[model samples]
Target: MKGIAFDALVDLFPGLGGWHYVPVPTEVRDAIGGHTTRGLIPVRAAIGTTAWDTSLQPMGDGSHFIALKAAVRRAEGITVGDRVTVTVSRR
Candidate 1:
């Protein structure tokens, strides 16, 4: 699966600080339905030549996406707007 990286603003409970993430778009999720598990999807994410293990998250509305860790982003020299390719399969 492939997607354009973008910053996702996360809003937690009241008084809690929000966070940001780079998400996998809905089309990518649709491309890997067989890998979904209880709304969470495990994936091997890569940008350019950098890769890492991570999981995809579901929005409250049922759309699913993934977050790129800061380390991965820094190592890959990627930020929001960068394009990434992700691989999902049974372990």
Candidate 2:
């Protein structure tokens, strides 16, 4: 249940072969903010539910933490420190 960072997200892009370059989108690029500490996190389930869970997979190693800006819109019941699932609305 760890959040991904920009460094990680970069690797998960479409293409990576030689002469192949699937660049990061503007939304993701803007969200990264040039750092690399944060990433595009996708919440698994409804927040505040006991069955909440999360995971993080590295996409790339940018050598630093990336700053991300995104909004969250949850319709389920959740609370701070409740350890519920979360989702980012806009990046």
Candidate 3:
């Protein structure tokens, strides 16, 4: 499938011990064939000029989120509550 791009707000999940993430929009999740039971989907993602390989974590709410590693966030100068443009594609 082709790459998907969108803007989303960075958020911290308390349950995940304050880990930051970008919620993958429902439409994008569907486009990527993501489901709650699908386990992690390997992907290549980019934010600003920082690019990395990570997996999209399926959430219990039938959604998925991309965990933002601290290094990636620091490289992009991003923080929780910031709006970031994300580009993702299955690897």
Candidate 4:
């Protein structure tokens, strides 16, 4: 099968823009003693995002998924500059 160009992929899925942004689920945060403060996204100055293991798959991976901070940065009311912060749990 032929693969489509990277830039042309977003045209297929309206939900997807420049990057995939998952809402930081509370369950994951609650597992690790929760965040020090309240509000979505443990980090500061964030609009919307969640701590998850993967950009495509955030579900199913208990005690295995690497929670990271993801935020959507938009340009001209669009989207860009998505960041990821991977963390390791202490055993």
Candidate 5:
């Protein structure tokens, strides 16, 4: 599958036990497929040279986000609040 690439700001989800993520743009979500009523959508994602197979989680507000694992962030030298370019494709 072709990957959709976009720039996003890494952010921390407040009051959710410190979940870090990058919000998937609506266009990118639409490109991969539309919003899910429930459950996560499997995906392959890359940030620079770091890549991982994860899932796109619905935010329950008609949007989606990809959780940024601590190891991935460490490998990419990124932290919350950093802007990043992410490439994602359906798995």
Candidate 6:
């Protein structure tokens, strides 16, 4: 399998109780084509060296992204707009 990694900024979703995320790039989406189920895609996501099992969720604009919970951010020492190298693989 091909390695998937890319830089993205941490984004915030207002009015959703402080939900934060990192938008998955198109390349990642294309690499895992048609793997979504009910708007969520299961994957093993990693930030730097911390790996976790998470789901990529769809946004209203026909795009998909991954949620970066506070724990992950804190563990990775990253904040919004901070470029992060995210890697994902099929779960």
lDDT of each: 0.55, 0.28, 0.86, 0.28, 0.89, 0.80
lDDT of 1: 0.55
Predicted candidate 6 versus true structure: per-residue lDDT over 1-91, tens digit per residue: 2358888888888885777898887668778763443478788888977888898888867678899977888898988778888988877
Highest lDDT: give the candidate number.
5
Better of 1 and 4 by lDDT: 1
- TM-scores, each model vs. reference: 0.58, 0.20, 0.87, 0.22, 0.89, 0.86
Pairs of colliding residues, candidate 6? none
Clashes of 4: 2
9-85, model 4: which lDDT tens digit per residue? 11111363433333333454554444423432232212223222232223334311222223322311223233333
- Residue 29's lDDT in candidate 2: 39
Q: How many backbone collisions does model 6 have?
A: 0
lDDT of 3: 0.86
Candidate 1 per-residue lDDT over residues 1-91, each given as its tens digit: 3533433432232355433345455656666553343477766665556767777777666566566666766776655555555445322
Best by TM-score: 5
lDDT of 2 at 20: 13
The candidate 2 region of ten consecutive residues with least summed lDDT is 64-73
Which residue pairs show backbone clashes in model 1? Answer: none
Better of 2 and 5 by lDDT: 5
Clashing pairs in 4: 24-49, 24-50
Model 1 stretches with alpha carbons more than 4 Å out: 1-19, 34-38, 81-91
**Tens digits of lDDT, candidate 2, 23-85:** 333344344243343454433322223223332222465332112211121433322222222
| Candidate achieving higher TM-score, 1 or 5 | 5
